[model samples]
Target: MAFEGIWNVVMPMGRSRELVRFSKTDLLSSLQIPSERHLLVAGLETKNDYFEGIPWIVIQHNLDVIRNITISTGPRTESVTKAVDLYLEQIKVRGNKTLSDY
Candidate 1:
């Protein structure tokens, strides 16, 4: 048998969750990180006894990437522009990086 890896992000919603699957572009665009080199790191992958020792590589990678993004909006935003502005502001505060930072 061949080892076929599947990557995804499972979001917690109350007692349930949603599955999000994406490619490299999705991860990059979501984080607003222009460079893959900025996100990828050495020895970032992990292996567990999870499901018979298959490594949870994708989960680890997603966790790291998602940490740098605001995937959800706050309650008071009430508008797309405000939510977007907030995300942009967050990125600005974290570092002087934006859509044009590349």
Candidate 2:
């Protein structure tokens, strides 16, 4: 399957963890980087497996080209949710602050 589309994912690389926004093309490009050999070396079709292998928790917001959603696979569910929650909280705070400025 062609992994092409906008996806919201939490990718944990080593000790560092952060939410990543990726278009399928962007993901393919990342796989080209030498540092990301682990993902490319195996020629993995299921890219999410490298993160945490299992059925990922997917929340679909809309049926459009840009699927702005959160995805987490396997035992790392908690971490993914936490990261997404934090991101949402930040957006909420920023929205509130913007309203206050008005």
Candidate 3:
């Protein structure tokens, strides 16, 4: 039995590759991992024994935001929060402009 794993995802604006774990969808013929945010970017999945994948349009995390918030008990929480905020801002400002007029 084979299992899905993380793959190198070239950051949109940066020249670095980030490893993101994604699963192959049997129904959608896509490699996507659902999230609370409205959207995300999915790169191509080439291990096509079962199905081929496509580069999906990025979107926002949807549903309950509070439930998605991580519950970590530590002093470094503030730093983590700041880092996440920065990432979100980067995505919001730079992520492929889905709605051109929006």
Candidate 4:
């Protein structure tokens, strides 16, 4: 699979912020795995003139094994958590183990 593509996303989380950066084929071989659906979550620390804080969650998904990714923020609230909740709900309903589970 080719390794290319970038997506920047932002979601609302109370007064805080949820942001994400996605990339492809960056950490596959080291993990030693075949093509499959994958999701990753991480936290980011940042300091700037405007803000000084850490984005404490990130989530990423490999949509068919041909793509890789990185997500800098995931769910962080009760009212809403972006598309991840729907995705996880789908997985749960379908009885499929998520990437984190694997």
Best by lDDT: 1
By how many angstroms RMSD does model 3 differ from the true structure?
Answer: 15.8
Please estimate how well model 4 matches the true structure, expressed as its whole-model Cα lDDT.
0.29
Error of 3 at 79 (Å): 0.3
Ranking by TM-score: 1, 2, 3, 4
For residues 1-102, what per-residue lDDT tens digits would candidate 2 score against the true structure?
A: 132232445565555665555554465455432112222212221124443211232212111101222333433435344433443343343322221121
Model 1, position 91, has a per-residue lDDT of 33
User: Quick one: RMSD of model 2?
Assistant: 16.9
Each candidate: RMSD: 16.0, 16.9, 15.8, 14.7
Residue 67: error of model 4 in Å?
A: 9.7
Write out the backbone clash pairs for model 1: none
Q: Model 4: which residue pairs collide?
A: 58-73
Candidates' lDDT values, in order? 0.36, 0.32, 0.30, 0.29
State model 2's lDDT.
0.32
Pick out the ten consecutive residues of candidate 3 with the lowest summed lDDT.
Answer: 38-47
Write one digit per residue (lDDT tens) for candidate 1, span 52-101.
Answer: 11133354443454345442333322332343344445433423333232
What TM-score would each prediction reach against the true structure?
A: 0.23, 0.23, 0.20, 0.18
Q: After superposition, how far is residue 63 of candidate 4 from its true place, in Å?
A: 1.7
Candidate 1 wrong stretches, greater than 4 Å: 1-14, 41-102
